[model samples]
Target: MSGSDETSQARALGEALATLRRERGLSQAEAGARIGMTSQGWGLYEAGKRSNLFRPDVQRRLTGALDATPEALVLQMGGEPASPEALPATGLSARGRVFDGAPLQTRRLRLETDELAPWASAGTVLEYVPGRWPRRGQGCVIQIDDGAQRVRLYDRADDAEVVVLGAGGLDRTERIARSRIQSMSAVTARFDDE
Candidate 1:
């Protein structure tokens, strides 16, 4: 294949791999750790910067780490080549919708503590879109009326409160009163130290 064609194929394959990893509910760090790889190493594959997608062994290793098969990865890429516009965007998918015909802005914050360890540790940077509502199991930033901010895994929300998982792990759930929230935004991407 020509160089451009190779790049296109690699990009498509990377998108497929990313989709599989997300479906398995794993962060890139977690997914890479499963196969003894660094998050950056795994991210290169997902970013299509790695050129080994054409290798069967590489494909098997990647898919296997997600409890998937190479066949599944191929299927995820679809039966035919992807058009340029159909390729995945370079960063996290846009979550916030335009409001009153205006676009929302993306923001970033660094974690100062490991308050949400395992999912997000200290020194990790998170990208969030202010107007987007976080889905269950996704990360979110909650700014309270007291001017304190928290990063936690979203659980569920009710009319009165928003539920989240604390650093204590999955069984440790906390509910913050909606009245006390100054703002809440969905985290779109996480970048851990290499």
Candidate 2:
């Protein structure tokens, strides 16, 4: 394959692997350990920073770690299937979006109200989006205070939709109707954390 094809295939494989790890609720560090790699190294691999996807050993390790047959992962990574049996259905649609930006900016935020119980606690990591605000229930990482604060915002997509922020506990939920929202941004893609 050409260099471009190789790069594309590598990226696709990297994304697939990352998605699988997230769906399994394994952290990058944990997945790395399973594959005999350090957490940091696994992060790079998931980010497609390494260019050795074609290596036999790497392929073997990945298959073993993901509990998938080599042929299944390989075909999903852009290789043609040798036979119908070689391809296993992963059940995920190929139409999902991928996050292609740098690590999202995060900020400390407090719940502005009681409606967002157990979701957004004060001083939690709020992922931010600079200039784009999402519709209700769209699932966005919002950036406030000029990229200083970031948090995941659950969009309701209604004119009066409220935003939920925070991850742990039941006292962190906050609601901000669309009319009350000052500004926002949409989270186009994310690394699924299962």
Candidate 3:
């Protein structure tokens, strides 16, 4: 091997952290102080001159001090960061990781039954946005009593209740009391196997 993976990761994280600190207009002393470290200590990490900088706790503490986040450094370390537009307005959020190594911005649900057929069939993967409300006539995932959620079309929703329709037709629908809904999300995309 050319070099240890841990060594390479440390160097990359250090460079990224340094860039992040500079972008925030903070000297190493100020940044370190916020995270309860010394200028020389922080500099070691920034210069890839220290090892503990790569630890998870250190990453969290240091990044938090810089008024940025580990996710920013994650991207800087050459890992993909989900698009800002796909993220929550005021908090950290990510759907999950995919095996193909591409960044994904939406939550996924696998269909187990053809009950919602035509719109989505069994084994189909549905992608949706958490904390997002569906537009009129859009598709969405509706949770029923904390069980596996179901994917259905948006019929209508009001403060007291939400009405979701299955693909069987407009005539087929279930009205869920707002209180009964464990959670709900807006379906943004769908995928099917070839």
Give the TM-score of each candidate.
0.47, 0.39, 0.43
lDDT of 1 by residue, 1-194 (tens): 57997787778889989988876566788778667899999999998888866666787788877767766676666553334354344321211222232465889999888778888888999999774557679998889899988888988664567789974665689889979988877898999977
lDDT of 3 by residue, 1-194 (tens): 13475566567778889887765445788677665779999998987777666555667788877646778776655565557566444322223443243453578888777767777788888888764556556778877786857678777654467778884554598788878887667787889955
Report the alpha-carbon TM-score of model 3 versus the true structure.
0.43
Candidate 2 lDDT for residue 58: 74
**Poorest lDDT segment (10 consecutive residues) of candidate 3:** 90-99
Give me the displacement of residue 54 in model 2, in angstroms. Answer: 1.3
The list of candidate 1 runs beyond 4 A from truth reads 1-100, 167-170
| Candidate 1: Cα lDDT at 65 | 72
Give candidate 1's whole-model lDDT.
0.75
Best by lDDT: 1
RMSD in Å for candidate 2, one decimal?
14.4
Least accurate stretch of 10 residues (summed lDDT) in model 2? 87-96
Residue 47, candidate 1: Cα error in Å is 37
lDDT of 3 at 70: 71
Could you arrange the candidates by TM-score from highest to lowest?
A: 1, 3, 2
